[model samples]
Target: MTAATQPLLPEGFRELEPYVVDWALPTRQERYDMRLSKDMTELGVFYDAIAPRAEAAIAHLDTLDLDALPEPELRLLRLLFSMILVSYAVNVFEQPSIPDAGAAFFDTLVEPAV
Candidate 1:
């Protein structure tokens, strides 16, 4: 099959495919930006969907070499990264942006190679 026709996520992760467009960001900044843009309800929906499958997803990713992940696996990794960001908002802050941290912006200058 052509790359264009390939699945967005690896097998067994098809359930998460629906979230790929919005949550599967490649960089920490992108995930952070997404977190900031969404509300608690939106973030909660994502959290609810992924949290249940996190252990299985991590196990699947662990079988692959991080530097050599194929397109679909890489996307799965990014989805996990996004879940991390959303978790903080859903569980801790209970809001999109940090509490009492108005107008203060923090940028993730560097992130580990995907």
Candidate 2:
């Protein structure tokens, strides 16, 4: 909580091998469900900060493939991600207040919050 040192996305996402920056893809469905979803009891705190429309969009989202989701969901995902980034821009970068199942994915230190 002092310095706030958790990375935002994955190492490859920040660095990238390929196709990582595409906004037309949904993040992994399980990961997305874990971080968001009010109907689901996990209710990650980061989920609390998301735009309500994005949350609704995510819930009804239909999967296209592992590499992609429907365009509507993908767009909503981008909006959700933008909200998260904004918080990191304004607040400290700490572990996303997700459930234990979700937090395990991000371990590297994020850059200092602005």
Candidate 3:
């Protein structure tokens, strides 16, 4: 099957496929950049979609080997990671960015392998 015809997320996570294009980023910096680019409304939308399914998603992912997750599972994992980044904005900051911080950015030099 062609890339477009292939599934972007695991079977159980088909509902989240809509978000994959925007939120299922592979790296910390990419996710962080995404978080910074959106407003509270957008971030909240993503948070609400994933929060309820967090436990189930984790359970599903735990069944797989982390070092060798299939592409769809890896995308799901990335979506989970994006959810984590969005939580801070939706729950804590109540905004898309850190308050009182000016032009600060994360220079992520290291990230765990997926």
Candidate 4:
């Protein structure tokens, strides 16, 4: 589809991501449990496997103090974190929606103040 006819993502996806990141600290376990898709779609039963893994990882993460984290651990964290992020970006934001956001942007911006 052309830029003018592309769809936009659900707004909640944008709002939820940072919140999810914040939860990565204290509610790490819960957030891990909630690591559904970008839109939190039910992608079969085994899709929830990442949560416990995150919890287990965090115990080790707490020991490192973020400064002395080894490259491999960091890489794994990045990979897991990105998976969470991309779930939102691709599945939520990039999912099909009503086209015309570009038009809407221009329409809202170009219109005379009312």
By TM-score, the candidates rank as: 1, 3, 4, 2
Query: Which portions of model 1 show Cα errors greater than 4 Å?
Result: 2-4
TM-score versus the correct structure, for each prediction: 0.93, 0.30, 0.93, 0.35
> Best-fitting candidate, measured by lDDT?
1
Cα lDDT, model 1, residue 14: 94
Segments of candidate 2 deviating more than 4 angstroms: 1-50, 62-66, 93-114
Count of residue pairs whose backbone atoms collide, per candidate: 0, 2, 0, 2
Q: Which ten contiguous residues of candidate 1 have the minimum total lDDT?
A: 105-114
Candidate 1 residue-wise lDDT, 1-114, digit = tens: 997778999999998999999998888998898898888888999999999999999999999999899989999999999999899899998888889987888777789876
For residue 94, model 1's alpha carbon misses the true position, in angstroms, by 0.6
RMSD of every prediction? 1.2, 15.6, 1.3, 17.1
lDDT of 4 by residue, 8-28 (tens): 212212222333332333223
lDDT score at residue 110, model 4, on the 0-100 scale: 39
Q: Clashing residue pairs, candidate 4?
A: 38-87, 38-88
lDDT of 3 by residue, 1-114 (tens): 997799988887898898999988878889988998998889989999998988999999999999999989988888999999999999998988888889876688988876
Write down the TM-score for model 1.
0.93
lDDT of each structure? 0.90, 0.38, 0.89, 0.39
